[model samples]
Target: SQQGEEDPQALSIQEGENATMNCSYKTSINNLQWYRQNSGRGLVHLILIRSNEREKHSGRLRVTLDTSKKSSSLLITASRAADTASYFCATDTTQGGSEKLVFGKGTKLTVNP
Candidate 1:
């Protein structure tokens, strides 16, 4: 499928711990992005990893892409209670000449303080 697929559908951890999520897709993509969404709110773009890029980091967030495996992983270091949210991996894919961001179901993370 052109849509991304995230694994370990849900996760729970204590504050100050680390969180890791993985995503896989079936088609080629120009870039893959990770997003975080708090409950009842819109998504916030975290980072984008281009097809040619291997890894990227922002603050406490780290993202990695392996184009050969069509997979990506997102790591959050020293997670806080505020980090509790649903995280999604999205890719820019074209369908019928129109480009769209296809997102995975997402992994819901629960951070307990």
Candidate 2:
């Protein structure tokens, strides 16, 4: 499957703690993107790293990509209650002339203050 699947359907943490999630895919991809969703709203793009890249960081969020292993991980350091949301990893597969993104089921993170 080209779709990415994230481990740990849900996570709970206290404020100022760290949260980590892992994702695994079954196909080759051009790039991987991580997104965050609040409640029932649409997803917001957090970061995107190409296949040629290994690791990328943005603010308190860090992402690591391993194309050879077809896996990736997302880490949030010093998590806050405001960071409680659903996180998803999406893969962009456009080799077949179909440019589409397949999203994972997502990991629901709950931050307790």
- Clash counts per candidate, in order, are 0, 0
lDDT per residue for candidate 1 within 1-113, as digits (tens), equals 44899988999999999999999998988899999999999999999999999999999999999999999999999999999999999998878898889999999999999
- The local distance difference test score of model 1 is 0.95
lDDT of 1 at 6: 94
lDDT of each candidate versus the true structure: 0.95, 0.95
- Lowest summed lDDT across 10 adjacent residues in model 2 is found at 1-10
Clashing pairs in 2: none
- Candidate 2 residue lDDT tens string, 25-58: 9898999999999999999999999999999999
Residue 76 in candidate 2, Cα distance off native in Å:
0.5
Q: If scored against the real structure, what TM-score would every candidate get?
A: 0.96, 0.96
